[model samples]
Target chain A: MRDAFHDELNALNDRLMQMTNLVRSAISRATTALLDADLQLAESVISQDAEVNRLYAEIETSIYELMATQQPVAVDLRTAITALRMGADLERMGDLAEHVAKIARMRHPVSAIPVEVRDTIVEMGQIAERLVTKTGSCIATRDVDLAKELEDDDDAMDRLHRRLFRVLLSKDWPHGIEPAVDITLIGRYYERYADHAVRVARDVVYLVTGSREFDDSAS
Target chain B: MRDAFHDELNALNDRLMQMTNLVRSAISRATTALLDADLQLAESVISQDAEVNRLYAEIETSIYELMATQQPVAVDLRTAITALRMGADLERMGDLAEHVAKIARMRHPVSAIPVEVRDTIVEMGQIAERLVTKTGSCIATRDVDLAKELEDDDDAMDRLHRRLFRVLLSKDWPHGIEPAVDITLIGRYYERYADHAVRVARDVVYLVTGSREFDDSAS
Candidate 1:
């Protein structure tokens, strides 16, 4: 029974890694879709979110089942509960990706991002992608130090987010309200995507350390 | 043992109700702060969010303890896990409210919502308050029908959100980019607050019906 439970735990970890990959792809493609004005890629990213959600549900159900059946205690119980929260975080990251894709699809044939701020959005996307990739490894290894490192990585994204705001609020921002709003939301999407990845890493940290000091505000 | 577990579950429910009240008050007061330019009220709302987070952490820890010790199955297991998710939803709702308050405080001595769109924001806040109130009750009673009704309440919010966008996009938007951006984010805070309320209510629906049909994209 112990071995079986360990097997199930391993399976849960594998599924979480799969989810991380899916979310990374979604954000990467969605960024391309937003930058290139590629409707086909946007549509694909939007459609693929269902798969992410499916995996989320699978992981969630499995976590609950593991808890109910195995009654894991101590570190094992923490691991199970953290997986549940991480699944939700990953699922939300996927939704943020979808929102980005929807924005791309909404402005088809025309990029959602203005050329002036395109570079910042591109960099934000790259940072988001890198953060999620690091988060996947952190979860896989249960490395608390790596998990803590994600917070610093998230700082870069937050800095970029603030810079986007500065550009928007600047007098030279030639983009009118429409594009400004779009860019504002798009920047938010990337910023929040990184936030969620950081959140997942934080949960991994809590799972390892049994501490809540790293909890960021809320969700 | 079973009775003790049920008692713990009831306590969890009570805590969740308390969280809903805190979140509702936060949004309501934050709206007033935004509309009235009430810096004191905004500060109060922002500071009080710590209490909401405290309750969230308390409830979360309790749920994990219950699950690990009791190892509830079937409906019991579902109830525990759902409570955990609902706690997160409520906590996030509080954070959204706090964000609104911070915005109000940041622009203090001046209202965040311009006079042109003030009424719309006021209505959105009212809808958010009503939705959370109903959500609290639905959670208390596990009323699936009432839970379904929240989606409609959220629809009203969505419509208002879109209307705000139309006004922003309209040729008659006299407010410049700063106020436009402020209004946009404020609208989103309320809209997302409502979305979390709907999510909690939907979780109640799922708890009672054992259905995942109403999973709203992601948490």
Candidate 2:
């Protein structure tokens, strides 16, 4: 019985890592779709988010069942519960990626980058990919040190997010309100994506330390 | 043992309701601060968010303790875990309110909202409050009917959200890019607040029904 419970726990860990990989691909494709105006890639990201959601649904069901039947306690209990949160965070990351894709779809054949802020979007996208990739490693390995380092990546994302605003708010901005609005929303999506990744990393820390260190005003 | 576990559950329920009320007020004051450029109200909302966070922490601690010691099963287990999720949703609603308040503070002595979109914001704020109030009731009463009704309010919020975009994108929009960005983010904060409120209600539904109805593309 104990072996079966540990096996279920290991299975849960595998599924979460799989989800991390999916969302990683998601943000990666989403950024490309936005920068290149690739409708097909955007469509792929948008439609494939259901796969991420389906994985989360399975994780939740497994956790619920594990708790109901096996009644895991202590470290095993913490691991099971934290997986549920990490899954939700990853699921939200998927949604944020899809949101970026929808923006790409909305501006199809007409890139939303606007050149002045294109580099910032590119860097933000890269940082988002890096953060989620590390987050997956942290979850699978339970590396608290790796999890702690996500804040630095998050800080980089924040810098780009602010730079995005600076570019938009500049007097020389000639894209008018439409692109500014698109960029604002887009910038928010990337920043939120980064935050959720950090949150998943944070959950890994919580799983290890049994304490949740909530960030101050992630928005 | 079961009775003590249930007593703990009841305490958790009360704390969640209290959190809902705090977030309800947070959104209310945040809206007033944004509309009226009342820095004091905005500051109040901003500072008081810590209270919401503290409450969430306490609830989390209690839930973790209950789970470790009690090992609740079946419905009792479901109630304990669901409380954790509902607490998280309410905590996020508090943060969303603070984001709105920060926007107000950033534009202090100068309203972030323009005259044209002012009414829309007012209505959005009112609906945010209504959604949260009903969310609190849903937590307390477990009334699935009231839980279902939050969808209509959410739909109304989504409609107003679209209306906001229309006004921002309108050719007659005179506010330029800065206010448009502010309005875009503020609209998103309200929309997300409504979404989170709906999620809490959905958790209530899940509590009673044991199945999660994942919404399609809330953003």
RMSD of each: 1.4, 1.2
Where does model 1 sit among the CAPRI classes?
A: medium
List of clashing residue pairs for candidate 1: none
Candidate 2 at residue B138, lDDT?
Answer: 90
Off by over 4 Å in 1: none
- Alpha-carbon error at A168 in model 2, in Å? 0.3
For model 1, what is the alpha-carbon lDDT of residue B186?
85
- When summed lDDT is taken over every stretch of 10 residues in candidate 1 chain B, the lowest stretch is B210-219
Best by DockQ: 2
If you score just chain A, what TM-score does every candidate get? 0.96, 0.97
Q: Please tell me which predicted candidate would have the highest TM-score against the true structure.
A: 2
Tens digits of lDDT, candidate 1, A19-82: 9999999999999999999999999999999999999889988887887788788888888888
Note the DockQ of each predicted structure: 0.60, 0.87
Model 2: per-residue Cα lDDT over B1-219, one tens digit each: 888998989999999999999999999999999999999999999999999999998998899899999999999889998999989999999999999999999999999999999999999999999999999999889999999999999999999999999999999999899999999999999999999999999989989988665445355
What is the C-alpha interface RMSD of model 1? 2.0
